[model samples]
Target: MEYSFGPLIDENSKILILGSLPGVRSLAEARYYAHPQNKFWKIIYGAWGKTPDADFDARYRFILGHGLALWDVVKCAEREGSADGSIRNETPNDIPALLAAHPNIRRIIFNGGFAFAKYKKYFGAPAIDYRKVLSTSPACAGRDREREEMWMEALGRSL
Candidate 1:
Protein backbone atom coordinates (compact mmCIF):
# COMPACT_ATOMS: atom_id res chain seq x y z
CA MET A 1 0.00 0.00 0.00
CA GLU A 2 1.18 3.51 -0.81
CA TYR A 3 0.54 5.92 2.02
CA SER A 4 -0.06 9.60 1.58
CA PHE A 5 1.52 12.39 3.54
CA GLY A 6 -0.29 14.05 6.43
CA PRO A 7 -2.29 17.20 5.76
CA LEU A 8 -0.73 20.64 5.62
CA ILE A 9 -3.33 22.40 7.71
CA ASP A 10 -3.75 24.72 10.61
CA GLU A 11 -6.62 26.18 12.62
CA ASN A 12 -6.70 29.30 10.47
CA SER A 13 -6.90 27.50 7.16
CA LYS A 14 -9.99 28.43 5.18
CA ILE A 15 -9.33 26.67 1.89
CA LEU A 16 -8.52 23.00 1.54
CA ILE A 17 -7.01 21.76 -1.71
CA LEU A 18 -7.27 18.01 -2.18
CA GLY A 19 -5.49 15.95 -4.78
CA SER A 20 -6.29 12.31 -5.66
CA LEU A 21 -3.02 10.95 -4.35
CA PRO A 22 0.64 11.81 -4.15
CA GLY A 23 2.56 10.86 -7.25
CA VAL A 24 5.84 8.94 -7.12
CA ARG A 25 7.99 12.07 -7.13
CA SER A 26 6.06 13.68 -4.30
CA LEU A 27 6.31 10.51 -2.21
CA ALA A 28 10.01 10.27 -2.85
CA GLU A 29 10.59 13.89 -1.83
CA ALA A 30 8.10 13.77 1.03
CA ARG A 31 6.50 16.91 -0.36
CA TYR A 32 3.30 17.70 -2.13
CA TYR A 33 3.58 18.39 -5.86
CA ALA A 34 7.29 17.68 -5.86
CA HIS A 35 7.35 16.56 -9.45
CA PRO A 36 9.49 19.00 -11.42
CA GLN A 37 6.97 19.49 -14.18
CA ASN A 38 3.89 19.81 -11.99
CA LYS A 39 2.37 23.27 -12.01
CA PHE A 40 0.67 23.11 -8.63
CA TRP A 41 3.07 25.49 -6.94
CA LYS A 42 3.22 27.85 -9.88
CA ILE A 43 -0.57 28.09 -10.05
CA ILE A 44 -0.80 28.74 -6.34
CA TYR A 45 1.99 31.29 -6.44
CA GLY A 46 0.30 33.09 -9.30
CA ALA A 47 -2.97 33.19 -7.42
CA TRP A 48 -1.20 34.57 -4.38
CA GLY A 49 0.86 37.06 -6.41
CA LYS A 50 4.06 35.36 -5.35
CA THR A 51 6.85 33.61 -7.17
CA PRO A 52 7.37 29.90 -6.85
CA ASP A 53 9.97 28.92 -4.30
CA ALA A 54 12.82 26.61 -5.20
CA ASP A 55 13.01 25.34 -1.65
CA PHE A 56 10.41 22.87 -0.48
CA ASP A 57 10.18 24.30 3.01
CA ALA A 58 9.64 27.80 1.70
CA ARG A 59 6.97 26.63 -0.71
CA TYR A 60 5.19 24.74 2.07
CA ARG A 61 5.38 27.75 4.34
CA PHE A 62 4.01 29.99 1.64
CA ILE A 63 0.98 27.72 1.18
CA LEU A 64 0.22 27.51 4.89
CA GLY A 65 0.77 31.21 5.42
CA HIS A 66 -1.97 31.86 2.91
CA GLY A 67 -4.46 29.84 4.93
CA LEU A 68 -4.59 27.05 2.39
CA ALA A 69 -4.57 23.44 3.48
CA LEU A 70 -3.14 20.75 1.22
CA TRP A 71 -3.77 17.04 1.25
CA ASP A 72 -4.90 14.09 -0.83
CA VAL A 73 -8.26 12.34 -1.10
CA VAL A 74 -6.71 8.93 -0.72
CA LYS A 75 -4.94 7.92 2.45
CA CYS A 76 -3.65 4.66 1.06
CA ALA A 77 -3.96 2.81 -2.22
CA GLU A 78 -2.51 0.03 -4.28
CA ARG A 79 -1.39 1.13 -7.67
CA GLU A 80 1.05 0.18 -10.37
CA GLY A 81 2.14 3.71 -11.01
CA SER A 82 1.61 7.40 -10.18
CA ALA A 83 -1.33 7.85 -12.51
CA ASP A 84 -4.65 8.22 -10.78
CA GLY A 85 -6.06 5.78 -13.33
CA SER A 86 -3.76 3.14 -11.90
CA ILE A 87 -5.10 3.54 -8.37
CA ARG A 88 -7.04 0.66 -6.78
CA ASN A 89 -7.96 -0.80 -3.42
CA GLU A 90 -7.89 2.69 -2.00
CA THR A 91 -8.65 3.95 1.46
CA PRO A 92 -9.95 7.49 1.53
CA ASN A 93 -8.91 10.15 3.96
CA ASP A 94 -11.17 10.99 6.90
CA ILE A 95 -12.36 14.28 5.51
CA PRO A 96 -15.27 14.62 7.88
CA ALA A 97 -12.93 14.50 10.80
CA LEU A 98 -10.69 17.00 9.08
CA LEU A 99 -13.59 19.37 8.61
CA ALA A 100 -14.55 18.99 12.22
CA ALA A 101 -11.02 19.75 13.29
CA HIS A 102 -10.74 22.76 11.01
CA PRO A 103 -13.98 24.62 11.41
CA ASN A 104 -12.51 27.63 9.66
CA ILE A 105 -12.20 25.68 6.43
CA ARG A 106 -15.09 27.00 4.41
CA ARG A 107 -14.12 25.75 0.96
CA ILE A 108 -12.84 22.44 -0.33
CA ILE A 109 -11.25 22.40 -3.78
CA PHE A 110 -10.58 19.16 -5.61
CA ASN A 111 -7.40 19.43 -7.68
CA GLY A 112 -8.81 17.39 -10.56
CA GLY A 113 -11.57 15.09 -11.78
CA PHE A 114 -10.06 12.08 -10.07
CA ALA A 115 -9.88 13.85 -6.75
CA PHE A 116 -13.44 15.10 -7.06
CA ALA A 117 -14.81 11.75 -8.16
CA LYS A 118 -13.05 9.83 -5.44
CA TYR A 119 -14.14 12.37 -2.84
CA LYS A 120 -17.74 12.22 -3.95
CA LYS A 121 -17.69 8.44 -3.99
CA TYR A 122 -16.10 8.09 -0.57
CA PHE A 123 -17.62 11.01 1.31
CA GLY A 124 -20.63 12.01 -0.76
CA ALA A 125 -21.46 15.71 -1.08
CA PRO A 126 -19.75 17.70 1.59
CA ALA A 127 -21.64 20.08 3.89
CA ILE A 128 -19.54 22.96 2.69
CA ASP A 129 -19.36 24.06 -0.91
CA TYR A 130 -16.61 22.77 -3.24
CA ARG A 131 -14.99 23.54 -6.55
CA LYS A 132 -13.27 21.18 -8.98
CA VAL A 133 -10.21 22.54 -10.74
CA LEU A 134 -8.14 21.00 -13.48
CA SER A 135 -5.21 18.88 -12.40
CA THR A 136 -1.83 20.55 -12.07
CA SER A 137 0.00 17.35 -12.83
CA PRO A 138 2.17 17.47 -15.95
CA ALA A 139 0.39 14.35 -17.18
CA CYS A 140 -2.75 16.41 -17.74
CA ALA A 141 -2.91 18.16 -21.06
CA GLY A 142 -3.47 21.92 -20.89
CA ARG A 143 -1.63 25.19 -21.06
CA ASP A 144 -0.30 26.27 -17.67
CA ARG A 145 -1.73 29.78 -17.98
CA GLU A 146 -5.19 28.46 -18.84
CA ARG A 147 -5.16 26.01 -15.94
CA GLU A 148 -3.92 28.74 -13.62
CA GLU A 149 -6.78 30.96 -14.69
CA MET A 150 -9.28 28.24 -13.94
CA TRP A 151 -7.72 27.61 -10.54
CA MET A 152 -7.67 31.33 -9.76
CA GLU A 153 -11.32 31.68 -10.72
CA ALA A 154 -12.34 28.80 -8.50
CA LEU A 155 -10.21 30.02 -5.62
CA GLY A 156 -11.53 33.56 -6.04
CA ARG A 157 -15.10 32.31 -5.99
CA SER A 158 -14.46 30.38 -2.82
CA LEU A 159 -12.84 33.33 -1.13
Candidate 2:
Protein backbone atom coordinates (compact mmCIF):
# COMPACT_ATOMS: atom_id res chain seq x y z
CA MET A 1 0.00 0.00 0.00
CA GLU A 2 1.12 3.54 -0.74
CA TYR A 3 0.99 5.56 2.46
CA SER A 4 0.75 9.29 2.31
CA PHE A 5 0.63 12.04 4.94
CA GLY A 6 -0.83 15.48 5.07
CA PRO A 7 1.36 18.54 5.00
CA LEU A 8 2.24 19.97 8.39
CA ILE A 9 2.81 23.73 8.76
CA ASP A 10 4.40 24.63 5.43
CA GLU A 11 7.31 24.08 3.12
CA ASN A 12 9.29 27.17 4.04
CA SER A 13 10.21 25.76 7.42
CA LYS A 14 13.88 26.10 8.31
CA ILE A 15 14.15 23.09 10.58
CA LEU A 16 12.78 19.62 9.83
CA ILE A 17 12.43 16.78 12.35
CA LEU A 18 11.74 13.31 10.99
CA GLY A 19 10.66 10.24 12.86
CA SER A 20 10.85 6.77 11.35
CA LEU A 21 7.12 6.16 11.66
CA PRO A 22 4.35 6.63 14.15
CA GLY A 23 4.24 4.25 17.05
CA VAL A 24 0.87 2.80 18.08
CA ARG A 25 0.22 5.58 20.58
CA SER A 26 0.64 8.35 18.07
CA LEU A 27 -1.46 6.53 15.51
CA ALA A 28 -4.21 5.97 18.01
CA GLU A 29 -4.13 9.57 19.22
CA ALA A 30 -3.94 10.96 15.70
CA ARG A 31 -1.23 13.28 16.95
CA TYR A 32 2.48 13.50 16.65
CA TYR A 33 4.40 12.85 19.86
CA ALA A 34 1.22 11.84 21.62
CA HIS A 35 2.68 9.11 23.77
CA PRO A 36 2.86 10.30 27.37
CA GLN A 37 6.04 8.38 28.05
CA ASN A 38 7.67 9.87 24.96
CA LYS A 39 9.90 12.78 26.00
CA PHE A 40 9.06 14.79 22.89
CA TRP A 41 6.51 17.06 24.51
CA LYS A 42 8.44 17.59 27.72
CA ILE A 43 11.66 18.32 25.90
CA ILE A 44 9.94 20.88 23.67
CA TYR A 45 8.18 22.50 26.57
CA GLY A 46 11.36 22.61 28.63
CA ALA A 47 13.27 24.12 25.75
CA TRP A 48 10.70 26.90 25.37
CA GLY A 49 9.91 27.47 29.05
CA LYS A 50 6.35 26.26 28.82
CA THR A 51 4.39 23.89 31.05
CA PRO A 52 5.81 20.44 30.48
CA ASP A 53 2.46 18.71 30.06
CA ALA A 54 0.81 21.15 27.71
CA ASP A 55 -2.03 19.97 25.49
CA PHE A 56 -1.67 19.17 21.80
CA ASP A 57 -2.55 22.61 20.50
CA ALA A 58 -0.20 24.27 22.94
CA ARG A 59 2.66 21.99 21.97
CA TYR A 60 1.96 22.35 18.25
CA ARG A 61 1.95 26.10 18.68
CA PHE A 62 5.32 25.87 20.31
CA ILE A 63 6.60 23.79 17.43
CA LEU A 64 5.45 26.31 14.82
CA GLY A 65 6.55 29.27 16.89
CA HIS A 66 10.03 27.80 16.82
CA GLY A 67 9.92 27.38 13.01
CA LEU A 68 10.25 23.64 13.23
CA ALA A 69 8.77 21.09 10.84
CA LEU A 70 7.71 17.70 12.20
CA TRP A 71 6.99 14.50 10.28
CA ASP A 72 7.93 10.88 9.71
CA VAL A 73 10.08 9.35 7.04
CA VAL A 74 7.61 6.66 6.06
CA LYS A 75 3.97 7.63 5.81
CA CYS A 76 2.91 3.98 6.05
CA ALA A 77 4.54 0.57 5.76
CA GLU A 78 3.19 -2.88 6.25
CA ARG A 79 4.01 -4.56 9.53
CA GLU A 80 2.72 -7.07 12.05
CA GLY A 81 2.31 -4.04 14.30
CA SER A 82 4.46 -1.28 15.86
CA ALA A 83 7.88 -2.85 15.90
CA ASP A 84 10.27 -1.21 13.45
CA GLY A 85 11.78 -4.52 12.54
CA SER A 86 8.41 -5.75 11.31
CA ILE A 87 8.17 -2.99 8.72
CA ARG A 88 7.75 -4.36 5.22
CA ASN A 89 6.26 -3.54 1.84
CA GLU A 90 8.09 -0.32 2.49
CA THR A 91 6.90 2.93 1.05
CA PRO A 92 8.83 6.01 1.98
CA ASN A 93 7.72 9.60 1.98
CA ASP A 94 8.78 11.65 -1.00
CA ILE A 95 11.52 13.60 0.73
CA PRO A 96 12.86 14.96 -2.52
CA ALA A 97 9.59 16.73 -3.10
CA LEU A 98 9.74 18.14 0.39
CA LEU A 99 13.28 19.33 -0.15
CA ALA A 100 12.32 20.98 -3.41
CA ALA A 101 9.43 22.73 -1.78
CA HIS A 102 11.35 23.73 1.32
CA PRO A 103 14.62 25.13 0.10
CA ASN A 104 14.94 27.15 3.28
CA ILE A 105 15.35 23.96 5.29
CA ARG A 106 18.98 24.12 6.38
CA ARG A 107 19.00 21.06 8.57
CA ILE A 108 17.09 17.81 9.11
CA ILE A 109 17.20 15.93 12.42
CA PHE A 110 16.18 12.32 12.60
CA ASN A 111 14.27 11.57 15.80
CA GLY A 112 16.11 8.30 16.43
CA GLY A 113 18.99 6.18 15.25
CA PHE A 114 16.45 3.93 13.53
CA ALA A 115 15.38 6.67 11.15
CA PHE A 116 18.97 7.65 10.39
CA ALA A 117 20.01 4.08 9.77
CA LYS A 118 16.93 3.41 7.64
CA TYR A 119 17.08 6.50 5.47
CA LYS A 120 20.74 7.42 5.39
CA LYS A 121 21.28 5.13 2.47
CA TYR A 122 18.60 6.96 0.51
CA PHE A 123 20.25 10.32 1.21
CA GLY A 124 22.31 9.74 -1.95
CA ALA A 125 24.61 12.62 -1.15
CA PRO A 126 28.32 12.84 -0.65
CA ALA A 127 29.38 11.96 2.88
CA ILE A 128 30.67 15.48 3.66
CA ASP A 129 27.62 17.11 2.13
CA TYR A 130 25.37 15.01 4.32
CA ARG A 131 26.28 17.18 7.30
CA LYS A 132 22.91 18.84 6.91
CA VAL A 133 21.76 16.15 9.32
CA LEU A 134 22.55 18.14 12.45
CA SER A 135 21.55 15.68 15.17
CA THR A 136 19.35 12.80 16.30
CA SER A 137 16.86 13.09 19.13
CA PRO A 138 16.71 10.80 22.16
CA ALA A 139 12.97 11.15 22.91
CA CYS A 140 12.58 8.36 20.41
CA ALA A 141 13.80 5.50 22.59
CA GLY A 142 12.04 6.44 25.85
CA ARG A 143 15.14 5.62 27.88
CA ASP A 144 17.33 8.74 27.80
CA ARG A 145 15.82 11.98 28.97
CA GLU A 146 19.20 13.67 29.26
CA ARG A 147 20.09 12.81 25.69
CA GLU A 148 16.68 13.99 24.59
CA GLU A 149 17.32 17.35 26.26
CA MET A 150 20.65 17.68 24.53
CA TRP A 151 19.14 16.95 21.14
CA MET A 152 16.28 19.28 21.95
CA GLU A 153 18.80 22.02 22.56
CA ALA A 154 20.51 21.19 19.29
CA LEU A 155 17.16 21.30 17.52
CA GLY A 156 16.41 24.65 19.14
CA ARG A 157 19.75 25.99 17.95
CA SER A 158 18.99 24.94 14.40
CA LEU A 159 16.12 27.38 14.44
On residues 37-67, what C-alpha lDDT tens digit does candidate 1 reach at each position? 9989988998868889899899888888888
Sliding window of 10 residues with minimal summed lDDT for model 1: 141-150
| Best-performing candidate as measured by lDDT | 1
Candidate 2 per-residue lDDT over residues 1-159, each given as its tens digit: 334345465645677777777767777777886667666666656666666545777777677777777877786788665656677767667776777777777777666656666666566542221223322333335446556565666666664
Local error of candidate 2 at 30, Å? 1.1
Give the clashing residue pairs of candidate 2, or none. Answer: none
Residue 93 deviation, candidate 2, in Å? 0.3
Against the hidden reference, what TM-scores do the models get?
0.96, 0.78
Residue 84's lDDT in candidate 1: 98
Candidate 1 structure, TM-score to reference = 0.96
